[model samples]
Target: MTQLIFINLPVADLDRSIAFYEAVGATKNPMFSDETAACMVVSDVIHVMLLTHDKWRSFTDRAIPDAQVSAQMLLCLSREDKAAVDATVAQAAGAGGLPDPNSPQDYGFMYGRSYADPDGHIWEVMWMDPTAVAAGPEAFAAHDLTPA
Candidate 1:
């Protein structure tokens, strides 16, 4: 069987989170959803479990850091092309997400943009040129990687 990923996130408002996710292209899965939790299906292999703060506390004793003020992790998703990446970011913003706080990244072969959800979880949407990828890392040799 193929391995699947389930990202469990602690949310302040279950319904709001679900709505945000749905607007960002995920669908709610009733099978694993309840009053305290909802399974957001991002793709066939990727699912996000949105848990209420109280429910999340039941799973761990650690304090839940306020995502708005803390750095936890960045979740990234790939799109079919550069346009798709940009479109997704726009959709996220229209759905109440914050646009990228950092500068945009454009590496010729790859392009990416980010947005923060209502709870401040960072999600990066990116796209890579298949031809460039097939050409291997050597194709990026001319790109500067040194710290300024």
Candidate 2:
């Protein structure tokens, strides 16, 4: 059975968060969305749940750390290629996210960039060459993911 990942984040504005996620290529699953929570599907196996503070509290009593100033987690999503990674970051930025909050990573075979949503949740988009990944990390000496 394939395991699925559901990253739940607390958002200040559900509507805005939904819009931002949609811009970044996540489609909202109406079947699991409501006024207090939105289930944004990134792929067949990945889903992001944007929850209101009230809704979040019902699930966990722990204080919700302000993602704006402090990062709770760095969520990453894989793209098809380097261009797709850049495109996702650009889309997030166009939707009001702060681009490149973290330093970009470029290994030629593996490229990545990040953007912070309006609530300051960071999402990293990455692309990796399948051939390079199969060869492992030792294959890249200086930004070369695959050995020629």
Q: Pick the candidate with the highest TM-score.
A: 1
**Total backbone clashes of model 2?**
0
TM-score of each: 0.94, 0.90
Report how far off residue 54 is in candidate 1 (Å). 0.8
Q: Weakest 10 consecutive residues, lDDT, candidate 1? A: 139-148
TM-score of 1: 0.94
Question: How many residue pairs clash (N, CA or C atoms closer than 3 angstroms) in each of the candidate models, in the order given?
Answer: 0, 0
Per-residue lDDT tens digits for candidate 1, residues 75-106, read: 99999998988888898899899988545798
Model 1 stretches with alpha carbons more than 4 Å out: 145-148
User: By TM-score, how accurate is candidate 2?
Assistant: 0.90
lDDT of each model, Cα atoms only?
A: 0.90, 0.90
Worst 10 residues of 2 by lDDT: 139-148
